[model samples]
Target: MIKKVLSFAVIGVSTVTLAIGLSPNTASAALGDQPEVFHSSYNPGKSTVTISTSNTEKKPVKASGYLSKYFKGYAHKAKNGKWQFHLDGYGDAEGLYNNVRNDQTVRVYLSEGKEQGAFDVKVKTIVKKNKVKKKKAIKISKAINGKNVKIKNNKRKSDVITIKKVSKNDKITIYNAKGKRLVQKTAKGNTIKIYVRQLGKKAGAVNVSTQKKGYKESGKIKVKYGRE
Candidate 1:
């Protein structure tokens, strides 16, 4: 009798199912609102960790997070959904940056109510001692009327070319058109004389370069005079 009893009832079963906490599997997560972290970075110099995240819904919410084992803190969220965690030394913030190292990666955990996330962020490399300012390219100048200046007439029969941006200990080397080493000597000053006649007026090029005490030699530049 019970198996055959298919009687019509009120259409409140959906409400009854909801009363029994039987939410649909396709139901939206966090009431269709999810949080997302789009960008993050840690600045070792300023002791600041910043993030760009989103709260899927329109309501603003506070977020709490921690940076590995360093410290627990709350991030300040801007109206535009940007988050910044400043750990400048102040009471519990002291030593927050002391243990952080350049290029070292650390774990980050964040939460905003039902939405939470975690990821690793690397600190930017900023070693003051390891940074080497790249020097400008060395341009071979020439003595123009006793004043060292860039060689204007590259086709002249000048026996000497000025070399600037080099040390006295640097070595200057001269080469013939056929890559033959003509002469090399310690740089004396801004101007040094070379045997331009070494080319013998055969359209040969006179190349010049300099090498620091222990570094590689600079590129050889052509400065040979035209045929006589």
Candidate 2:
């Protein structure tokens, strides 16, 4: 049986660091830090959005203007480079981005101080999760520690283990406690199921992770399970 040692949700950040311009110099050059969009989270109750960013040097960065359609604000920074917006479609926050719904695509551009050029666009789908109050101990496994390729929740009401969906065609590999391969396959629908009988009896614990192209492979996350 696989037992969960803790109860929590996986909070993660996705980063995009590409810049575009009409001319050569502007495309690659900037006086400012040219911050990278770290992650974004939404609040349904308050209708607020917080965009977090960090610069190349991690010193600090500033936004001179809002050139995008969904958000608008001036000199937007308090500390640690967090810009705030409300989704009312008036004043600071524009509502047409109301189209940026769960599983819906949202496009954001990063421009630098005082010079606005045609931006190379990168479209990202921001998926939001709603919190559910539970009284019993959670059933799923979490990241063994703060590491990449988290074991996302797919076992809430299941007896077996599951990995959260990954991008199509990516590989999902599972291993035994002592480091032996039990199952390996490509994600056709972007998700995989963990079966106890397939892994056999000696898999006291298992490690789960997916293959990220071009990035180093990670399979260090531990999922504690035992034989009956």
Candidate 3:
């Protein structure tokens, strides 16, 4: 009986060892030492960040951390048998780090699906400021003769007429087909917006004109009723 019990115990130990060797989870545990590698870049003009990974794993990767708040990032497989991650709206990071004017150092953490550990990457990038050009003043006589006014007409209510490239103190006049002045306004800035409600259902051809300090009395610009 003692010999039979010792033989049963040895058989059980061997069976458990064989099961462990055949388990997929146990096999994957042996690869825990290997981690994925990544490269990252930032473009200020395009407001994008791109990451390329060395691994071709089918699982998706995610990015997070200080810079991640300003960007939306996703991973996909590249043509070169590697993984590529794109981060959009990277220029919004300037709002996250208000004190960073020219260049910044940001941290990003990347992880695979359901993975508890993440790979950390530090990136240094330059932030460029966008320049806005001012609009030049429009030649009053040329605009009026060429009918360069932008009109937004409302059938049942007041119509809005906008004259761009105007200077302060420029006078805008609206006249009916019979040469009766309907409304006259003086421009307050580089552009003048006039809401015309005096037409009062008259749907004939109207005209617009402008007068400036150094410019001649502009030629009439014919305007159509209820049209921009």
Highest lDDT: which candidate? 3
Model 3 residue 94 lDDT score: 27
Any runs in candidate 1 off by more than 4 Å, and if so which?
1-158, 161-165
Clashes of 3: 0
lDDT of candidate 2 over 48-88, digit per residue (tens): 23222222213322222343432422222348853322212
Report the lDDT of model 1 for residue 4.
21
List runs of model 2 lying over 4 Å from the truth. Answer: 1-160, 194-203
Candidate 1 C-alpha lDDT tens digits along 128-182:
2335899977654332222222332233554544555555667778777678887
Minimal lDDT window, size 10, model 2: 43-52
Lowest-sum lDDT 10-residue window in model 1: 55-64
Most accurate candidate by TM-score: 3
Top-down lDDT ranking:
3, 1, 2
C-alpha lDDT of all candidate models, in order: 0.45, 0.41, 0.52
**How are the candidates ranked when ordered by TM-score, highest leading?**
3, 1, 2
lDDT of 3: 0.52
Q: Considering TM-score, which of the candidate structures 2 and 3 is the better prediction for this target?
A: 3
Per-model TM-score versus the true fold:
0.29, 0.27, 0.33
